[model samples]
Target: MPQAVRTAIVGTGHRAQLFTEGLAKRDGYDVVALCDPNSVRMAFHNRMLLAAGRRTAHLWPPARYDEMLRVERVELVVVTSVDATHDRYIEAALRAGVRVICEKPITTDAVKAQSILDTVRETGGSLSVAYNYRFNPVHRRVRQLLADGAIGTVHSVHFEWMLDVSHGADYFRRWHRDKSNSGGLMVHKASHHFDLVNWWLGAEPHTVYARGQLAFYGPGPEHGYARDYVRAHGSSAADDDPFALQLADNATMRDLYLDAEGEDGYYRDRNVFAPGVSIEDDMAVLVSYDTGATMTYHLTAYSPAEGYRVMFNGSGGRLELNVEESTFTSITLRPLWSEPVDHTVDHEHEGHGGADPRVLAALLDGEQTEGAEVADARQAALALVTGLAANRSFETGLPVRTADILKL
Candidate 1:
């Protein structure tokens, strides 16, 4: 058998654990080193590996990333860092002649995204954006149906994504509450939805107009949230607060975040209704695609349910898909027929509806699962620019052209 690919992962956050643990179970990949600014988080990851009976990876500070890459002989760098920091690691890996598999949104802004694209072009580097939703069995089936012309000549699309309190509230509690960190939910969360549309329709966005607001998770008396503490870990306000996530409550969370809080002073449970939170909780966008297809999309972070409803209107007929992801309910597909078909998709795996494992397999082993396509730099850039254009539109209150935002 061929030697395992030497890999290094930056950012020892919750997401990084998924990749590390998944790689530990596979043979063709070896996680050699882990880099992060906080050493406590790195220690937590090592502890996790030891607990799982896997070899603990060496840890390095963020400043020593280049040294780690060279000394560790890392062939591939897996970036699971914060959204704003993704471009930095991606550029470093490309410049070092190492391949990269980065978590989505590419970067928080247009300049960073363009910088990454430029570095990729300059270094002739290979980068794959992990848009794992494409690997979902139900989503893969949709792609197959679309490819097979189940809905001939797609003309328009309407997508609505709802994030329930458990998942959605977590975003506001962490670094994602700041636009600089996560680019708000538009570029951060909506990247997944936008990429799905782009891949499913085989088109890129041309123009975007958007409206968004921070109606829920911010300082507002009208929101009826009365909280005095900034963080929940040792605060009295969090004792019985439903909105507060006590890191000490769960063993895993305690070890990963609560114990790791000393190194970076990064609190995992910041008040959701705290002041200075700049990201929007509700958004509506209109996009025109290069393929002449128009899309109307809406994202609500605080919702009663966690799922999405997407409908593709075609010249021949319409294909509608509604997924309630939280309860593992059946995914309903209505093909403009009198009786629509309902598919009970049991992924029987964890993380992003079993897409995470498939993504890792494809990246590490070159394994091609159904509907899984390696997302290149250009495709990732287009999807990112689309959301960035929408963000620009939201700020300027005008329709923004994707080409202008890209300026490629």
Candidate 2:
């Protein structure tokens, strides 16, 4: 490997900021080029680099993405593009023999997942999927306790994740609301939880049965929250709506989306309650793991509070976790005939209890992470099996065997 990884960014969207900003704080990771369809969005990132006192990178349109790799002498590609477009950028980089660090979900569906997988096998290139939740101190502790057999042989898990209106509604308003684009929340959002469960247990998902519905978001008199506007940016209807995201209020948002909208016309603040939502706001899934551990999971988008509760029933006893975002994260461990031991971590940091910084170091700085192994191309695809299975089950109304769609 070179002393500095001459990296090219595939997307200049909001999620791409994590990589751009993180690279700024690290050494031996030089961002040499920015490739995106939106020139304005690319310029926004250059401005960010300039503010950080770093040299600006040359911007290239998507048509010349491959050309940029050769011209820039790129050694790595960081993909933070739309959910569905990840595979294209990832596969291209892999085939070009350039290493890659991709944001979660790897790719939205199995086909894209398989395509990337095939490229990895062909090129033997490096691909790291950033599953940052694994780096959260609380989650790392959970893995340690479980690995120590504090909970014995785990048999079943009940995991429920709730997204508050602010964060959850944003997904509905974005391109993620389209199933074709994001593979719904099953693939878009819940892949994190699924990957966490797989990591915590060191097991693979075998089959999944699921049910989901668009009970909250989307337009309709039946949904109740429908506003008479397509987007929130300049609409009076959104003036009083609490869920409206005012891109103008946030400097980064305004620069990245609102100010750049004239170039691409992509709205950063779409009305969450408007029509065209094809994804579900409520979802439930039951998964069977290769270790014979069963998991019942549920995700609800609109919740009064945000966080998740996970209960693990094992041969010895039960271990439970309750993470309430605004409050605290608690973990209780109980062995048979033993009193429960409780642990709590102060949640002062905004980015997943400081997991973001840790993961950034692991991904950008070549630091060895202590918790769940950061996903490689194959591990990343394995994390997608349960999500893809659940997504299939959502449509078929039947249990989907993971082996049927578990391609790596």
Candidate 3:
């Protein structure tokens, strides 16, 4: 391992900023450049770096992010780009002999994913997908218990995760609305859930039978063809209605999505009932894994309380987890909790059941993460392959095998 991971970022959005800030506050990785096609997004991050008193010499404007890869001689690349564009930056980094740390759901389709897998094989460059949930503490505990035979031979996993309308609708509002970009909710959002199941069971998905529909969102018979619910625009409108997302209004979101809307007119706060949404708001899947274990998974977007319940049953006893009922990162505070609270960092003790900071530290410090097991590219590919197969299963109304997709 290099003394310092010379790193460059290809996307300067919310996730990119989080990784950059995490890297900046750490010792091993040096983030040399931040790049986005939108100058405003790039400038937002550059200003953030400056405010943090980090050097801005290497901050590459959106247009030059790719060009900076050659000039900066970055040894590693942290890819936080949008789902559709992830393969390009990753491919470039691998081509340039740079290791890549990509955010999850690497690509929206199988052909591109195969291409990337091939590139990684051809280049022998390290490609680590960031499935941070696996790095979370409680999930780790559950994995350990399963491995120790505390849960015995796992036979089935029953998992249900819900994102409330406020948080889930945001997906339909943003670039994720395009199936070509997001691969629907199963591949885009369920990737996290599917990956967790794979890691816990230590098995890849064999076949998937899914059923999903754009249940609540899009031009519904109830709402007619209205494009927006509030008819508001820009960051100032973020707080106008608590139930509605004002990505154009929220300063953080505005800088990332709204202000940069010029490059692409995709609104990040369109009403969930709008006519253009391309993704589903409710989904369910039955997945069979290669290890002879099976899983029944359900996801919905209209719940009042956001949280998840995953019960793992092995030959031994069963392990169950119930995430607190609330959205992971809702923009506005829900009234149930009194007083102002910073759930992101201040809740470290309760952070994903104390999995958040630990994962961050592990990713930054190169130490063994606390809860879950370490994953290689094959495991990462397996997780992704399962999610993609589930998506196909939902579409084709048939069972799609992960092995069939990978042609294994």
Q: Who wins the TM-score comparison?
A: 2
lDDT of 3 by residue, 257-366 (tens): 77787876756666556566777888888999878999999999877777888877766456666665432421111122244222222223354545555556655566
Q: List the residue pairs that clash in candidate 1.
A: none
lDDT of 1 by residue, 1-408 (tens): 988888888998888888878777777778889999988888887876777677888999988898999999999999999999999899999999999999997899999998999999999999999988888887887787778887788999999999987789899898999899999999999998899999999998999999999878788747666588899888998787888998987988888788888778888899888877889999999999999999999999889788888888887677777778756545444565556666546754467888888887887778989777868899888778878998999989999999888855
TM-score of each: 0.95, 0.97, 0.87
Residue 335 deviation, candidate 1, in Å?
Answer: 4.9
Name model 2 segments beyond 4 Å from true: 1-3, 221-223
Q: Candidate 3: what lDDT?
A: 0.73
Supply candidate 3's per-residue lDDT for 331.
15
Q: How would you encode candidate 2's per-residue C-alpha lDDT over 1-408 as one tens digit per residue? A: 557778899889887888888776566778889998888889988877887777889999888888998999999899998889899888888889898999988988888887888889989999999888898888988899899998899999999999999988889877888888898999889999999999999998998999999888887537566678888888999998888999889988888888888887888789888878999999999999999999999999999889999999999999999999878789999889979998665664667777888888888767887765678887788888888998889889999998899564
Where is model 3 poorest over a 10-residue stretch in terms of lDDT?
328-337
* Model 1 local distance difference test score: 0.86
Task: Point to the candidate with the largest lDDT.
Answer: 2
lDDT of 3 at 31: 72
